[model samples]
Target: MVSAAYRRVNGGHDLAESNIVIYTHPTCEICVTVKMELDEQGKAYEEIDLAEFPERWSEVEELADGDRITPVTVENGEVTIGYHGIGCMFYD
Candidate 1:
């Protein structure tokens, strides 16, 4: 069963099952914006803050192919680094 928070955002879909993950940092404006967009779209995602979880920084680095950046979005095995004016690849 999907969690109550996940259900509220994704219409009863389990976010973990979807495998949507976002890598972010606390001071990044782009990260904040991307998070807002995700919330607005009602998409459930797992946000990993590098500041809070330093161990996950390597994961983001690998996903971004060594480019250390914030707001790295991963959805269903697809990785998107950086915000390009719109939302994540799975936004729509």
Candidate 2:
């Protein structure tokens, strides 16, 4: 059974199924790098282009703790504000 906190984070989202959600822009270098890494690992993801859906920026902001950072990723409800570089930069 999932913990209460995890369930709360899940919030009716299918992150329990391992679906990853990436908020990105096509021209974002860090976004590209993150996608490439995920591709190399054969991980599947759903990408939402902020450039195309400006309305979703608020959601990104929410996930990023009010920071307007690109490439906000939500995997199983774990929010990652930016690409976790090889040196562990830009990540929580």
Candidate 3:
């Protein structure tokens, strides 16, 4: 389940000034860690669980252009394929 702190912005909904979407699986430690980091930073993000909605896997793959990896992040219109800890920055 996604944390209530993060809002679910999808289907062309208008996002906040900072919009972030993360594709993750429940068992991925990296995914959990990254979400924690985002929470600590006071950043809100929408989390999509591939395990729950396997149909969304293609979205992540399209963002990666073939490489499918966990912890895939999309901020605004920019896509990041992996976690980069606290140093990771999302652009608008």
Listed per candidate, the RMSD to the true structure in angstroms reads 8.3, 9.5, 6.7
Residue 1 lDDT in candidate 3: 57
TM-score of decoy 1: 0.72
Greater TM-score among 2 and 3 belongs to: 3
Cα deviation at 92, candidate 1, in Å, is 35
Model 2 bad stretches (over 4 Å): 1-18, 85-92
Q: Which should have the higher lDDT, number 2 or number 3?
A: 3
TM-score per prediction, in order, is: 0.72, 0.70, 0.74
Determine which window of 10 residues in candidate 2 has minimal summed lDDT. Answer: 2-11
Residue 56 alpha-carbon offset, candidate 2, angstroms: 0.4
**CA displacement after TM-score superposition, residue 49 of candidate 3 (Å):** 0.5
Question: CA lDDT of 29 in candidate 3?
Answer: 80
Q: What tens digits encode model 1's per-residue C-alpha lDDT throughout 71-92?
A: 8888788888888943222210
The total of clashing pairs for model 3 equals 0
Show model 1 residue runs off by greater than 4 Å: 1-18, 85-92
